[model samples]
Structures are given as C-alpha cells and as structure tokens.
Target: MSIEDRKQKIIAEFSMFDDWMDKYNLLIEMGKSLPVIDPHHKTKSNLISGCQSRVWLQARYENNRVYFTANSDAVITKGIVSLLIRVFNGLPPKEIIEADTAFLDKIGLKEHLSPTRSNGLTSMIKQMKLYALAFKTKHDSDKKED
Candidate 1:
C-alpha cells in the first residue's frame, strides 16, 4: 500500500481510542509486533544519538528501494519507529525521503509524547531520512556510472 494509505489506516486505528492511556496501550501492543533487529546491526554506529534510550536503525538498499529495521531499548520508542517503518519501508529512496509525517500529529501521537520522547521521535525520523538520502545518492551515482 501507499504511504498515505498506511498512514490513514494508523490514524483510523488511533481514533478508535478516546483516551491517551488507551493510545499508550496501543503503542505498547504495536511495539510487541515490531521485528527484532539483527544482532550484527545493533552496533553503536547504528544508534540514534539524541534518544534517551538506545535506538539502533539499519537500512538496506535493494532494487532501488530502501528498507529499514530498527530496535529501541524503550517500548514506546520501538512502537514509534515501527509506525514510521510501516509507512516508509520497501519504498524508493526518494519516496522515503519525501514522505510527509503530519499523520503523526493527526494521530495525536506527537502532542501526547513526553518532551524527551518527542525529541527521540524526531531523531528517529531524521535518521530514516538520512538513510534514504544516502541510498539515493549511491543509486544515482551508480546509474551515472552505468
């Protein structure tokens, strides 16, 4: 599905819960479903620097698309990253880099997060886009060489 469609689905899911506590529970449940990051990719190099908890993100480039896998020491952070990956994964690097994240606000996630978690979320999104940029640059260079 397209990123907008995936984001809309998440917004609809979050809308089902009237309380912030319920939304937090939903995030934790979503965390449980996040795929575990490979042990080899969980290195210091992959760690997101601004997060209070350790967040390791790794990107793989294949067939002109960038795919991400991430893990966080904090459950809420894990869920947040999972949501981002759901929207951005398996897409072309340019699409991943350009995807709008306003759905996060529409879902009431950003406003409800603690200040530290909000910073961490921003770091996560930045890192994802950085990875996409790197992939796009490499792919563009290779195409020129070909």
Candidate 2:
C-alpha cells in the first residue's frame, strides 16, 4: 500500500480510541509485533543519538527501494519506529525521502508525546530520511554511470 493509505489506516485506528491511555496500549501492542533486529546491526553505527532510549536502525537498498529494520530499548519507541518502517519499507528511496509525514500531526501523536519523546521521534524521522538520501544518491550515481 502507499504511504498515505498506511497513514490513513493508522489514523482510523487511533480514532477508535477516545483516550490517550488506549493509544498507549495500542502502541505497546504494536511494539510487541516489531521484528527483532539483527544482532549484527545492533551496533553504535546504527544507534540514534538523540533518543533517551537506545534505538538502532539499519537500512538496505534493494531493487531501487529502501528496506529498514530497527529496535528500541523502550517499547513506545519501538512502536514509533515500527510505524515509520511500515510507511518507508519497500518504497523507492526518493519517495521515502519525500513523504510529508503530516499523518503524525493528524493523529495528534506529536503534541501528545512528552517533549523528550517527541524529540526522539523527530530524530528517528531525520535518521530515516538520511538513510533514504544516501540510498538515493548511490542509486542516482549508478544510473549516471550506466
């Protein structure tokens, strides 16, 4: 599905809950479903620096798309990254980099988060976009050489 479709689905899911606690429970449930990150990628290189909790993310470029796998020591952070991966995974690098991410605001997630967690969330998005940029650059260069 397209990122917008995925985002809308999430928005609909969140709308079903009338309280933030319910959202937290939903996030925890989502966290439980996050795939375990490869032990090899759980290194300093993949650690997102700004998060209060440790988050490790790795991206690979294949067939002109960027695939991501990640882990976070904090459950809520894990869910946050999982959501991002859902939107970004299997998408072309340029599309990943260009995604607007307004769904985050539409769902009221950003304002509802604690300031530190919100910062961490922003950092996570930045890191993902950086990875997409790197992949896009490499792919563009390869095309130039072709």
Candidate 3:
C-alpha cells in the first residue's frame, strides 16, 4: 500500500479512541507487535541520540528499497518507531526521503507526546531519512557506473 493509505489507516485506527488513555493503550499494543530487532545490530552506531530512551535503528538497502529495524527501551518509543517503520519500510530510498510527515500531525501523535519523546521522534525520522539519502546516493552512483 502507499504511504498515504497507511497513514489514513492509522488515522482511522486512532479515531476509534475517544480518550488519550485508550490511544496510549493502542500504542502499547502496537509496540508489542513490532518485530524483534537483531541483537547484533543494536550497536552504538545504530543508536539514536537525543532520545530519553535508548533507540537503536538500522537500515539496509536491498532490491532498490530501504528496510529498517529498530528497538527502543521505552515502550511508547518502540511503538512510535514501529509506526514509522510501517510507513517507510520496503520503500524506495527516494520515496522515503521525499515523503511528507504531515500525517504524524494528522494522527495527533506529535501533540500527544512529551517534549523529550517528541524530540526523539523527530530524531528518529531524521535518522531514517539520512539512511535513505545515503542509499539513494549509493544507488545513483551505481547506476551511473552501469
């Protein structure tokens, strides 16, 4: 599905919750559904700075798409990353880099988060885009060489 489709689905899901408590519960459940990240990739290099919790994110480019695996020590953070991964995973590097993040505000996720968590979320998005940029650059270079 497209990123817009995924965002709309998440918005619909969040719309079901009348209260922040219920939304938070849903977030916890989403966190539970995140696939476990490989321990080997949980290195200092993969760690995202500025997060109150330890969040490790690893990205790989395969078949012209970028795939991400991430883990966070905090449950809410884990859920937030999982949501991002859901939108971004398996997408072309250019697509990921160009995707708009307004859906986050539309889902009321940014406003609901604490200041630190919000910063962490921003950092996570930045890091993911940076990885996409790197992959896009490499991919473009490879094409030129071909």
Residue-level lDDT of model 3, residues 1-146, one tens digit each, is: 98889889999998898888898888878888776679999999999998888999999899999999999999988988998898999999988999988787766686634456436888888899999999999989999999
The TM-scores, one per candidate, come to 0.93, 0.93, 0.93
Q: Tell me how many clashing residue pairs each candidate has.
A: 0, 0, 0
What is the model-wide C-alpha lDDT for candidate 1? 0.87
Query: Which regions of candidate 3 are displaced past 4 Å?
Result: 112-118
Q: Compared with the true structure, what per-residue lDDT tens digits does model 2 show for residues 18-131?
A: 898998788878878776689999999999988888999998888988889899989988988888887788999888889988788766587624456435888888899999
Supply the TM-score for candidate 1: 0.93
Sort every candidate by lDDT, greatest first.
Answer: 3, 1, 2
Error of 2 at 94 (Å): 0.9
* Runs in model 2 lying further than 4 Å from the true structure: 112-118
